[model samples]
Target: MTTAAITEETKAGDANGATAREGRGDLLDQVSASPRPRVSASSSPSPSSPPRAEEIAVRVVGLVKRYADGTEANRGIDLEVGRGEIVSILGANGAGKTTFLRQLTTELRPTAGRVEVFGVDADREPRRAKGMMGVAPQEAGLFESLTVREHFELFARLKGLAKREARAAAAEVMCGLDLVREARRRVGALSGGQRRRILVGLALLGRPPLLVLDEPTTGLDPDSRRAVWQVIRRAVAAGATAILSTHYMEEAERLSDRVAVIAGGRLAAIGTLEELFARLDKTYRVTWRDEFGAERSNLFGTFAEARAFVARESLSEFSIARVSLEDVYFALAGRRLTDAGGAAGGTNVTGAAGAAGETRKEGAR
Candidate 1:
């Protein structure tokens, strides 16, 4: 839909003059009554074992989200997060990735279907459902007036960690986020990368069984981004399940066990990178311009398959290439992930305004 035709569903008040929070009741009732799918986290690792329903930590069945302005942000999406799995949702801007995540965490009510986290309905029991979740939004959500310790303190409190225990947890998290030295410094005074790291740290503060991070590394220098990757891996290793939303295909390729491509609010594809590529039937395109003035290109399933073909065909001046996740992103979204949001979201995650709040609101990754 065009911008002129869209009304913001995120506006301040509800249609009834009550706060929008009250409007959630009807959605909550539907969510509360829906059937739940469960999956166990500690089942045996047999390769041939089929995934059991009880082993799923998060499930979205026929999930749909439509904005008040008639824009459907999620068009009948079905997704599952196994115990301890990192499932990445990849898309370009306006592709409905974040909107879908918002549904999983109950920040946005689904217009149809349900979201279940650890056997609890997010729509019906949002608070109880959230207790099992830790969400790190793309935008830096830290309060400028609060120090690193205070930031984690707020999260720990929300997660039900006690005061003295919360302080200890905050210190440990600050150390991991590389903000130990700034624990006492006001968040407003920290550098951009520092704040981003701290936001990640806060998400981990609760030690929730399920973690949902929206654009966890949108902004930051290469080093800071790498640091976040390390932290995420650690989180997964500890048996916590995670859902990552990101525009960076490389990040998703490296971290996710499975990924779903969203386009214009629809789920275009869902599977492992290899599985989706296989389903798309996209082949490795080997291209070469020969001395004989002929342009040669070929498709192969495996690098070995391509190599054998090259030798058999005696294609001397050939280059072998495979479809990249970035390629898949474009084929599904109709635009480059990096280009849709632009490099600006990464470099000026705080956006151009640079007022601390503006900067904080600029980027989430």
Candidate 2:
């Protein structure tokens, strides 16, 4: 299938680019900081778009991280997450997503670029940065030395809660996470889901304004997954802003106010689901049975502009519907979302083009 026929991802194909060339030799975390020039706001900020005026919770501007081993992880990607919004960082492996997450939480300092968490320069004021944010990594980071109550106690202390207040805060967290029953259980003995719950519980201890989760449900069963979603919703209701990196498309769809699709360490698209779909021209799906006992389905950009087509062709099997986020993902990426058919590092980024080819190739079979 032609790339355009399958996905709606637009790119200016130069797959092999300068960033990829520079970041070829460092350890995963040791990737060199991006060497790109910085981004400048207009002397007069655009009040119409009002990016600066808006209470943006997280702003990533021209982020580039190039490892010393010559592996470039991020390449001039720009992103903005508004206050109280849930944004999804959607990408395949090595898409610079984890790096983005690390930088925001002050876990990995950016080699270059500015990360403003709650309107502060994080690099210049890391303590201030860490103080206002909560992080739930893919792997839980609780201490094996502590019991559930102790784990909560430790995190509350980290948030600067006094002894009595910390205890009170811990109690609230345990109640919110439905972990009161396991308050005395050692964290080391908790199951994976329980562990994730604690991770989230730790982040929510102080009702932080910003919450960052790195694949918060990596090993969870369906039920546990829903349980975590509940916790996230409660956090948002408490006026928190969240940015989560996830490969699970369904999770992204359900939790995100907008989704940012990243490829080759650059953003392919960023918008609400409907806004992204609008990038596609309206189209129709036509299906019918052939004389040879086969079913044929095809997509068209137009319905032959017929007023009576729907009435005339009462084919019950064919229904009019809008494309889903999955369809939009396929259209933009030019491949099946589930078609991860390669080795451990097998992913969809095929080149280092400064910019990928910028055409949504109409791909229909």
Candidate 3:
């Protein structure tokens, strides 16, 4: 499908950019020393109209990342994320999801292309650009010697909060993530899920205008995962834009205003779930075990068509279900979201809005 056809742009007004003198490793340290910058403003009002460049929270054009060994992790990706929206990047492991995020956060410099965060050139002014965002990497080291409350308060302070403000922000974040009870517990003493929550909490500390999270809920249980989801929703609700990369189909389906699929180090498809679903010709999926007990699957436009096929094949064991985001990934990326192998090329389905129109749900702005 043409990327332009599925890509959604929401215009925003304007946001002030900051200037800092530190690198990624010293981001927090610099924040602690420098004054906090003002948060970015609101998003565009209408989806149908074109947005001004300033309305976009994140703008990436021709973004490319090549390692020293000549490995191209990202290849000319272009995307625009509006303010006050949550966009999820989905892909199989090593499909360049993290690579794309790293470049966006200025953690890794792109070999080519430009990145703008709230109208600031991240590549040229990494510190200033980073000041407008809060990031949660796929893996981050925490202070094991510090208590949970200490971690939050200290990070909040590092984000330019005053001692009193830092304490209050810490309390609010802990309470929101259900980590209040573990407030006094040492980081090394907490469970893995609890530690994960702490990482998310750190990003939410200063309520930065933009959040860049890499699998924020990877190791959490159902309840804890939902807690993080709520926290994200609250952040967006309060006017912050979020961009996250996740392996969970449900997370992408439920949390994102727009879902982007990365395959072979490139954006393969992107749109609302309905927009992506409409790209497919069939609405139902049929799966069954064959004579050798191996599984087989097919898509059908109607239930009757699927049933008829089963009867014709004389298959005794089969099941039919509705097509979902997972199917969309496979159809557009030519592989499952969980696959580790390279993409094999995509199905014939291309472009958006094929058939599923009535079921389309307007994404929350």
Candidate 4:
């Protein structure tokens, strides 16, 4: 997708840009020694038409990250997320999902490309850009000595809340994350899932306009995971735009407005779930047990075609279903969703180029 360039009139330091950066650092510092966290006025807003560059919450152009060991984790990635939209980045284990998020959060500096958050250049002013966002890294160190409530309250204060506001915010977060019952318990005594919840709660303290979460529910039980999802939904309902990386297809399908598939350090495809599903010709799926009792599956353009294939194969037991996001993922990445390792070269079946080519062909026709 092409992102319109930010006009000089909207570049940082302009009157409007200054308003965007205002209170990002000063307001919080005024309340305490803690740096002020900047938040956009609203994470989610109803826009009747396409958003302009200045309206984007995050913009990444030609982003590239190369490590000292000569490993390139990202390559020429271009993405734009509008205010109030939930965008999910999906990929195999080493397909650069974390790398992309880290750069967006300013946790890791990119070797090349430009990143802008809320109109501020992240590369030149990471701290200022970060003030506009709440980030929950994949792994973070929590103080075991702090109680759950203490952790939330303290972090709220650190995010620039006053004493009374901090307490109220902590209470709200605890209730939202279902950590109220464990509020007074020390972090060290909490289970892994509980600690994970605390980490997520910390990021939500001030209801920052943007939330960048890297697998926020990784270790939680199903119930806890659902609770977290509710918290995220509530945040979005209140106008928070969220970007997250998740292994759970259900999470992506349910939570995201758009899904981005990354492969070989590049964005393989990005669109709504329906748009991605449309990329595949085989929209029908057939599954059956072979003579050896092993499961076998195939895809066809239609249910009738799939049924006919089963009949031709003399399969007695088979099921036909609509295509799912997993099929789109496998088609794009040329591997199952659960597969690990880097994007294997020449293995992508439906990458960005292929998708673009398909679009061009349709337009030509």
Best by TM-score: 3
| lDDT at residue 238 of model 2 (Cα atoms) | 72
| Worst lDDT 10-window in candidate 4 | 356-365
lDDT of 1 by residue, 95-188 (tens): 7888888888898899999999988999999999988888887764568898777888877987899998898889877766677889899988
Q: Report the C-alpha lDDT of model 4 over 230-283, residue by residue, as the tens digit.
A: 777678777888899988876777667788888778888877655565566555
Which runs of model 3 end up more than 4 angstroms from their true locations? 1-51, 342-365
Compare the candidates by lDDT and give the number of the best one. Answer: 3
**RMSD for each of the candidates:** 17.3, 13.4, 13.7, 15.1
Total colliding residue pairs, candidate 4: 4
- Using all chains and alpha carbons, the TM-scores for the candidates as numbered come to 0.70, 0.70, 0.79, 0.79
Q: lDDT of all predictions, in order shown?
A: 0.66, 0.64, 0.74, 0.71
lDDT of 3: 0.74
What's model 4's lDDT at 74?
97
* Per-residue lDDT of candidate 2, residues 35-97 (tens digit): 112122121111223145467888888888888897777777778888877888776666667
How do all the candidates rank in terms of lDDT, highest first? 3, 4, 1, 2
Q: After superposition on all CA atoms, how large is the RMSD of candidate 2?
A: 13.4
Relative to the unseen true structure, what is the C-alpha lDDT of residue 196 in candidate 1, on a scale of 0 to 100? 78
